[model samples]
Target chain A: MHTNEKTVAKILFIVAVLCGLSALSLADVVAGNGPSPLIIFDGSKDFSTSSVEFGTVYRGPVHFTHGRHINEHAVSCGKCHHDDSGEPINDLEFGDGVDTCTDCHYEETLLRGKALEGMSQEEVIEHYPNAMHELCISCHKEMNNKTHTLSAPEACRSCHGVKK
Target chain B: MQKKNSKNMKNGVSRREFMRFLGLTTGAAAGSLLLQAPGLAAESSGATLPKFKIHTLNSTAEKIYKCKPGIKRFNEANMAFKQVGKEIGQPFFHPLAANLKKNVANSEIGSGIKVDSPDEARMHLAFSMGAGTWNNMFGPYGEGKENQGLLSWNPLYVPKDLAAHPLHDPNAVDLTKKIKQMSRIYGADMTGVAKLNRKWVYSKTCRNMYDASPARTKPMVFSDVKTPRETDGELVIPESVTNAIVFVVGMPRASLQLSPSSTQTMGGTGMGYGRMGLTAVALAEAIRSLGYNAIPCMNDTGLSVPMAIDAGLGQLGRLGYLVTPWFGPHVRIGKVLTDMPLVADRPIDFGVTEYCETCGICARECPSGAISADRERSYTPPASAGSCSNPGALKWHVDGKKCLRWWMESGNGCSRCMDVCPYTRMTWTDNYDGNPDPDKFWDLNLAPFGYQSVKY
Candidate 1:
């Protein structure tokens, strides 16, 4: 194949895999549908692991860790996330770089899209101290389901501590 | 005609031809053209957004104070009152203390310090405040106490009845306006209005009064605190007249960080206070002139803290002090409460809470360790009721006792806590040589401004 053709084929292959994983994750919600719509990617994982393009930002590759969620944690995708039809929301793709929670979530649209509603902007900013607690507690609770794990409260100071 | 049509079909569409095609469908042209610059289109339509950065200190340091907890005692080594006693033998030399002394001395000689011009007086006052009362080092804070052996104040303090002076009346209107105008004319940077919050007032037992003409000394007393007379309480001022126009006279941050001497810092505060006094006096006279009530006071009438806070100048910081964004805790405050109807500003919350949460550098730098080390909680102090505690209301309160002790030990009084405050430090940019350059010339003039600039 010509080099251009090969590059195009590779891109198509990655996109197909990302789409398939997203569909599988949302299999329960859109079980009867033609394809699941949401695509999830963990950027920190792969970039930290292998070399990738530099100087140009890229939306993280969608690595569907379906087995970990379904087999290990037994999380049915519906419990944690949702897949809907439309231009992808929350995760805006610009060239390549993906903006994270601190982006739009800083001053505007924190916990956007109905996850949290009716909170004043100040209250949402204050949410970090408590929201972080819940995230850690939930993860830890799940991990120590069978054995003892860290029992500390998940307050910001509980882990981050005070700065002098 | 057939040949010409064939030739036309054979040639590709020119720029003009493309424009002609674009005229056929507006939406299609826009859609296809937008594809050429996806990033620009995304930005314009609000698809791309900028991320924010979190300001925080070292994680381990934070954990030490919050998680790995122990009995956190308030450090009391840096007390100012105590420092006055230790430094008594030294020249009553604070620039502010000295400046005040000169006025008092002028009063003593029966020849008040005369000025050829307002500018000269201003320069003299600024110099006196910065250098302190000439060779006379004993200051107002410690002079009356027997332990200090400092007797005889400059003639200025001799006028114990300035509040009751025949030339003045709290109800004067013209006087109040004059005071306000005079204060700004003299050099106050910001002013505000608030009803006095009595909760911050120190009881009579906490202070002493000096009456020099009769050569009589008496313990300070407030009849309202002791007798609780209705007239004593209400006649002080009605809620309407309870309005106080607060003053924020800027201090040079540079001198503060130099850590020169208690005298130096006091000079800055003293100059501000002197200006505040002049304004209050003028304002009271103005009010009297206008046939209204005005209470002109630099230090004694009521508490200054809450009034300043309510005036919307700045938020109280973790150090248990007002932290103005422009000058931080580097400036001194005073006010004139009158029946003057003026507009009030709104309270601001500009991420100080988050900034303080992640940064407890003040608590660490506090010489007396008076600042709380943990998250805010409720507690009552022994001295006064209604007087707010440091932690309960989502604030970091400094332990005044520990802070006081440090002031005593430092001799000149320690502002290390205020001195090290990040807010006190000016923000600056690094030049090519990695040296910080203050964004403004005013910053270069002050030591703290320059110090903070470099540190940043």
Candidate 2:
């Protein structure tokens, strides 16, 4: 009778340990930081996951293809995502939460022409639209020059829409 | 084109040489420079220039206006006062009253009794009536009464909660941009900001013509008040109001083409006035919504032309009207004075001074001979201009009394000067006279809002 009781107790203890291990693994997957969180890198199909939409107050929203830049164009995450001091964030993995472009460069209006006449480089980059424009257009222009073709969109209508 | 170029070259002024003389080498730059220095190429080629003399030193108003040192702000009553047998009657209002019989006769002809078709008369009445809607709703004079109309000086629609906490953005640059964007959305064709020049503000409101009492006219005073307020004696503007947001609304070119014809041309003028009132009121309301004090004005409270010029909207033309780069003299000015901090735009020189000097089409086309044909600008107005002429600045002054008399005789307003100005064409086309056929006007599909976009 004693031996049977001991055998039952031993089996119950083994079952409890297995359940504890499974709960921890489930928590990891739900957190989105685990390798199990599958991020589809298809630009056309999974637009919500593959592209970042920037909503503007006075103009049309811009849709930037994250998947296409990473998978097809071979652009690393460090190219755009930067730290508070403007140092690139290298080794950025899938599902890593990042600050939006406007989070730091947060002026509501575009600053250019005479407005930017006396502003320093740092001050100029503080304007939301101006900074985004400088970043995207400069890169696109450089790419076009390198390839010797107008492949990458550089003009305002290419990103914002044709109406403006 | 080739023959003209060769002819120019024979005069030792090649196309490239002409461009170089204008301080540019490229075609685009030269074309732009031509606006600033017209007739220079002709001068080089020894062609006969216009009789008028140009202010060669500068293209600014300071150069053009030969002002007397102690020039005081003119009284509005002296110019616009309307009394039964007064020598100086209000240009727009008195003419309408004086020409009742002539107007009725003109209306009969316009209604197709004299003329075969009623198309011209119908369109004229429709445009005039439709265009006057906004101006009538909001007073043309910008009375600045509290909660009276859309052009009220006080806040109209700001909620209690929002008013309690005004916009806290410290960045004036961003605010200016937002205001400019809002102005365009509100219906302004062009927008500019300028530091308020107190000299432009009227010293006193025009008195009620029918009133026999002396108290009818109210003094306009700037005081250390929180907001603009009106009293029985005065219209008080706060000294804190430091900036003016000027707006320009373009008049329809098609309607303006029917110049001496009062029916069509008056309709165009009315349309500009109506749009100006609407834009000014809406913009003023918008600024108030953001917890800023604003005073909306249209053809009142201040001189719009000088304020508009200061705001970088345009330069003053010889016809005593604001000529914009986009619309020339075919625009009505509206303004809103506010306490909100903004970056003022710098005044621009697009060559209006030089161009107006040689282009005397406006002066020559005046049916009443109201416009001056003098070669030089003077501090004194022409003797026939009457007391309505404010003569402190040196520029060609129109004979207002004669001009008003013509309106009475014609049974409607006349815009002959506006019609014939070369700037109205906005191109290098010479001998371009717009022949307005009222019969064919209805059949043509005009652009929405009566304005057509001009692409460079």
Candidate 3:
């Protein structure tokens, strides 16, 4: 999705305030710099893996194990990541093309019924929340079916903690 | 309109919309101001300071040496002296001899000779503190013979009780200007005067430095002494010593460039301190020769950075080093406490506060992760990080303990922050001139509107 530089800076700033800069790590955190934070994406709270144009508010942290999936599960990079064209993204470097769901699939960009049906596969994924649901649930379903596993947390409460 | 509103309201409100409701936009609006909050908060509060003070005599603005209360001595409160007396770790420059032992054949670079290889030179610079000084650098440190030299100096015990010169003008600011000129000639790149800050003085000697009759050599309780007096091992500054002259000496920039790495080029930092020792000794003697009592100091009395900042040498940078406009963090500090009535210089603003907020080059390159990357400065240091960081100052604090650990890990110390400091190196985006020709590269040389080109 298209995002400007100013928007990017605001996102990083908000995240720094959220992270609670301690006297020791304040320099490393607040500056939004030092040994590439992307190297730690599920990166820093400020500099998100997906979004920059619009900021993020969180209920709880989402634990994504991309490294584990690659090394242990023998997952291919293209299985999850791709360009808007719906083509597999092969040569993903350290901080290659990545975006948040809302960046492209904001409410305005979402599609349904005739609109959803007429669009190409890549175009359909641009529908944001819908795209996130389809991608996650489908992958989980496939994984569960293959492994014959139970308790994969099919509902929102299963993955996201319900605030008391 | 209702239908469109309903369409957008599919899932409560958007995160962006919610943030707007939370009033975080105010935070966004104050971004630039917030970036400056760290440095400015303490600076603006200068006038309200009580026990601590800001001497803005001849400077552009108030000086920034917020201090601990009461008169102190040279050795007792200084961490460097404690490091030496405690013998917990090797002397900071202990590795220099070994570095020189493994030195390569001497080579020629322009007029100077490179007795050590590039790696060895770098290693030496990184490890070149060299047991500090026999006098413990700042003032009296140890007892007996160790307290000989400047440490044993007392204005009362002058070699020849020379009568005060009849022409000695205590009120003349020209005395300070002359001292500044001599300081530059004697190796200081920049110099300023401030009323002696007792709060910044050391509370006592790390070791008893009493070189007196045993009758007068009993150590007083740390709580007992108020104004400085003869108190056994604990050295004290007399009330007569009313003013202080602090100076900044340049480091070899080319040597610092190979920092965080051992290249035998690291000798620059050590060499800078060494030069400071010489400069302080000579300058102090000159001040004393003018019939004013003077005590030279280099890293021994109290914290030099605060004194340097108070003396208007530079502002504190993000990495917690003084960021001089001319030399950046690539300079050593020296001080001379005397009774001479020199006009205190006003503090300076070099835009380092704002610059370091955005520029984290030092923190980013710091191998030890000692430097903070936080955009805003903190008033205190993290607990249990390192002994090197004695927090409580209102500025960006580094994990000096971590930095020292890295120095050990690297078989020497690392100065990666200074290496990457934007002010240290001269580039298209950086400051002017080169590291050599100290007069051209040092902050003292920068913005010397009224001063002439230094003849040296």
Candidate 4:
């Protein structure tokens, strides 16, 4: 009835508004720079494979061994790669090559949308590694039943730091 | 915490304690407490109200859980981020789009999607005021025909299961069984129980009297604001009604499959809505018949999620929908909260997380991108419940605001994602091979019929 009473009500409404928005599910994984980018590995286009002979130099499209990962982890393709529609940042403009996992799984993004809403590409890439680790490790623990691997190496070098 | 009342009015203690006391046995004690502490009692007697003062964030909190500006104008604004080719009034339409949008509009915002903003608000107000709306499509059976016969005049009374009646008297058991049985007869697909957890009840959303006597927190004429508590800031269970019987009514599979295609989609959703109304009426009437207080709810009042979870109806899933074993996310929920005692169901964990991770179809297909991309890292999923920001919880909390916006923006209430959810598919079959035998279960009659029956 009073001005103060109305103000208090407004503040309470604001808080509820914030809480309601964040109440669905928390984003814990990082996509590109924030949450781990959900990788959409197009088995047809995204990857190429090779059985290289000892002295042959293989300079081909950046072909990841899509079959090896699925067979080794006993994972259905949907786990690591989802259909393009589920990308956390719908504007990624990448039809099938999107890989921001943390965008949907990061605690902040899960509560909020992609954190780097208007940031540059470089800024996101800077925070990408930590976000990826947090995202991947958490899934590893909660979803160990599905995957054979016990843990992902903490170091970024483990998965990305390889050179033949 | 409840404030005290009475200064040794009944005992050697202060007047506040007597009024604030939470152990009162009758109306006389409440009257005395109020008389002893006029400030604590305020405009009414101490014997009527609860111990706490009621306050809502704003008038809007009474409207949408998230007080988003867009929510206030939800019908007017097309808030979704649409792709280039998918503009409004396009020649080539997304076949399922129209139906899905209408369904979303009916449930989330209510009324048709393009209803003028003010008219939409009026429609919402009408329903809220119990005036009912044309789009409401269903109403309590006895309330009026304006409700489209969604509910029965005499609620479906399920006699409580006597074996689990909490009362010591043997007669109460018969009454309980009567209530439970009648609920099934009224078409409740499944039902179960859990104790009335007071915490799930709303603390201050509606009008109520809180007797300051600190002696008892019991409400006297608390009728309007009946919902399961989750915002009590504490998960307190009421001493009375130690059980909750939750029910689910399945929607037609044919209609749901044609989601986003306005006409066909409404049948599925309408049935679901009708089921909720029907169930609520039945449960409430059944409880009332037993001479116990019961509240029937189709959508308004207490939080349904926790009650559903505790009642063992379903588990929270990745798309933020209740995933029940029998119907997945395809069924509609309606509940009746009562003081009647009954047996409780256990919480189930049937590899929803595993399934969600392997089948990211719902999250992918979400046009508004509300479904969470992450799997459950720990036991909980981050909250994605409200408007812009997702609530940080243990499961995928869809951004209801974004989802609603997309529905409006697309000019068709959308259930594309719900349609695509692997869980939404009817897994139940007579074959018993743990899979639907496509030949028998997947009706081929759908495709041709659906294609031919377009009014738009």
Candidate 5:
């Protein structure tokens, strides 16, 4: 009876944790999104590491140097920034509202993946990391879809230096 | 204009008709009178050029290289800039971007910076090559804001005097000498001429020929020429082109001598391209001023290497670069196709093929192992088709596919093989062809013929 009670408590605790994460994401969705800075995750410092590593099967941290992208490269700010809806937020400039990408992507609920009263349990699981995978990666695909060579990093360790 | 074989065809539309079509010949009241001249074909205005037998194709390069219609747009070949942005993601673009932009914004001379660590340094180099190089010059040119690059490549509003005039020097020898002299004056390191082999010309221009032909003149019925007319996205060249005048522009040998993956390495290559564009424009205008319709072109519409070889500029080296006796492989080539009468230079037999039989330095030094280390030049590229090589020729081919892939990885156009080439080091920096020795052509048989032995 004691072991059974402990098992029930652990399951309840995990449920509570999942619930807490969803609630925070819901709050972020209500606030909406603006912009983000370039982030590098080496798997050591606890940033919101994805259940999938950069949207892959492995869970490694990605290395991205922001100074090169925004300032050095001419890809333009509009390529990354977007509102909660599919609408793009093209008004953002260099270094404007720059912060952690996970501040909104990992915590906020993307408007596209909203839950309704009649939705299934799988619908609820569409949260932070899923939204990132949909947005940033697809943009890269759209840019290089017509070319011959693989322009964007689609593999596991391309952006993420290694497992660590 | 073309001379010697410029026989006026009896029923063809004359240049007068073309001028009238361009609206330059406003006084067309004479009607059929201008068209009735029987002996008009005998006049000096005929734009035909004499065909000289090109002796340069007598080498192994000729036996291997086959002529094709044309090449596809190098959009795929030019994907080096875009691939890095996506593979590494946007974050890699900016932090390295700021430093790269700042470095170029200053006068781009010398090895610019030394970063904190090797990683940071690499990131900086990547961003610089992707975003900071002088790639601003190579693009389509048109009216107003779109004409951000070289306009000479396009046929916009040209004066009548410039396009249709009597050849300034009717003598082919004097004209060739003056033209070569003027080429060097406009920054070409070496210049040579040849009877243009039509096989070398693109049967049809690949897409993106920019529709800048004279037929596309606006406000005239000939405006169709301004728009590139492609049967199926393939551009075609008119048959008027007869003589091929090609020139070589030297790169800063010191920069390429640095490490291949370094910023200085790529910066030098980029700088050469930008400089070549300028030289081509200047050379084209000089030819035009001499009363010839010269079409200035770079690595477009045809094969530059083969054309350079046919023009007696240099022989093909092991690494596929045109190894001029003076600068070796450290040069960029440009050319102007014209009808102006000029003497063709015979191809030199300096024994580059025999030397390549023993030398394997470039292939061994290649970072991506793209070059073949074999002693013999094959009829086809030694590397497979997937390695970025176009099949059709047999030569000591480098794996261009791997070469491009390496460039994508290094964040710069890798010139690692060029760094250690012994020939690039022996460049004779002079005002003209410095080696005027009668036996300069005989040094190929010698194991090591030091220039110090001969009077400088």
Candidate 6:
């Protein structure tokens, strides 16, 4: 009876470890080497997670839900994560060590107005803020319009805290 | 007049026919004619002149200066000066009245008291003295009362022969360039031509601050007159004067950074006003030399912010000042109204509206809480603020009474809003830490005339 109980206990411990691993994998899938569940997009050069680490910021750092977009929204990884040929990487999975958005869209400042006047749409998306804003804002706007509810934020103040 | 007639003949359009087409015979078609006259004049000039290089970072003229759907143009009589003067029972003829009173009350050797140190007082006096020298010598209104100074409506020193035979450049494009170049040579840091918006022009000039008597105010009229004249009952600006050459004179950045009670701050503000007078007078004289009827103005004839916006100098910020991309609010505006045909510049929008929407630094940092901190803009001023604000335009209405009261109590003008603005720094790389040390100002090398070179 004692031997049978020990064997059952070992099996239960394995199952619990497996469940924890699955949860971590799901969280890591969209984290992109940053903090899990929530990612702070602050355009830091040294990849500092703290928003206050920077000297001055034009706007408040965007607090993005990484896990919620993946698990709740059921959004495909390929929708935002893409390869060099501008093609989505459909096979991207957990612990894949994906590149950050700023790694490719590397401009320090967001160029708008006359600066983007003559540039092609593809060229204009290369700026860091442009790329992120286009992806996030467009999706949020689409979701809001489709649902006929403001579940998603579409205005500047909704995403970034008012700077004082 | 003869040159204009000859040019009209060369363009194959008779003056009478052109006038008829313009509906100028009615003498009531000022605004619409003024709007359409530039393009018509350019077409008659008979040359496809190269477009002037756009100097601004971005221009969206159509999007700016549009009153909200239900709003109307603001009346000039309700402007801050007139309103404040009525409340205080004193004619607020000049901006320096409060500062002068403070000087006498404090019994300070200089124009402003230095609560911090003697260096601050000396710096304030040095800048104020320079500015006062120019502003006092030239008429504050730039009306050239009795042809006394350089701000004269009529050319003071230009030869009579030159004034009689105006330059007959039918090509407005070339003329526009020439006028802009002349303006720069005459000490304008930035120059732009904009077709005058009639709504900005005052319906009547306030002759006396508190008096509503007919003799105390003069109607600003557009008439068949060939030149701008100040008659006993009216200030007649000719209908031919359709364009305004607006320019900017930037103040010293170092001095402005020390604001909200510092004498050094007053120094910078004083210097900017002084330079504005000098530039406006010089540019007006140059325009007159070209045989055009030019009236130099420094904050007197019409509102400067709207005219500057129309001229593409800058956008209006929450502080109720022209926040230029180059100099931010640390600049003074000057203008010359003329009949000279010139291509008007499109107004610019360089993200000031968007940035100001999110950033309420100026309001938060304001010593008197004069600036509005509301997230949305409104057409009406706050009820508690009273009639100091002219409330027809859509904007963040600042409380002029509260602002002036602070100025009086502080013993000098406060520019806390101007100093704390993000645009004032023109970059987000450096953190601003309140007023900088005034003692260090004497140690740093500065540009000639105490202005900073354009950084961005």
Candidate number achieving the greatest DockQ relative to the actual structure? 4
DockQ, each predicted model: 0.01, 0.00, 0.01, 0.02, 0.01, 0.01
Q: What's the true lDDT of residue B87 in model 5?
A: 37
TM-score, model 1 to reference: 0.40
Per-residue alpha-carbon lDDT of model 1 for B1-456, expressed as tens digits? 545533443353455754554353233223212111001111222222322221222222112123223322111111222222222321112211232233333421001223344444344334434433311232222222211212111112212222122232233344334444444443344554444444333332122322102112222222323111123222223344546677664444433443312323334444444444444444444443333445555444444555666655455676666665445565556665555554443343334555555455565544334565443322322121112232223345445533432332222334555555555542111111111121222234223212222222
lDDT string, candidate 5, A1-164, tens digits = 24643443232221110000011111122122311111111112222223211111123465665576667545666566655563556677556775455655454442211122354433432455455555555554455443422355442223433232
lDDT per residue (tens digit) for residues A1-164 in model 4:
34643443232221111100011111111102322112111112111112111111111123346565456655455554544463333232225576565564444222122343475543543464434444454444344223211122211222332222
**Poorest lDDT segment (10 consecutive residues) of candidate 1 chain B:** B33-42
The lDDT for every candidate, in the order shown, is 0.35, 0.56, 0.45, 0.38, 0.44, 0.56
Kindly report which residue pairs in candidate 6 clash with one another: none
- Pairs clashing in candidate 2? B66-B394
Question: Chain B, model 5, TM-score against the native?
Answer: 0.62
Superposed Cα deviation of residue B249, candidate 5 (Å): 1.2
Model 4 regions more than 4 Å off? A1-122, A125-164, B1-177, B203-242, B377-392, B426-456
lDDT of 6 by residue, B381-420 (tens): 8654675566667677788655654443344456767776
TM-score of each: 0.40, 0.59, 0.50, 0.44, 0.50, 0.59
Q: What is the C-alpha RMSD of each candidate to the true structure, in Å?
A: 32.8, 37.6, 25.9, 23.1, 24.8, 25.8
Model 1 error, position B406 (Å)? 1.7
Model 4 is docked with a DockQ of: 0.02
Error of 4 at B402 (Å): 0.9
lDDT of 5 by residue, B286-375 (tens): 665455656666655456777788777667787878876545677777777776788876565445665555655566455545666555
- RMSD of candidate 2 to true structure, Å: 37.6
Ranking by TM-score: 6, 2, 3, 5, 4, 1
lDDT of 1 by residue, A128-152 (tens): 4233333444554344322221222
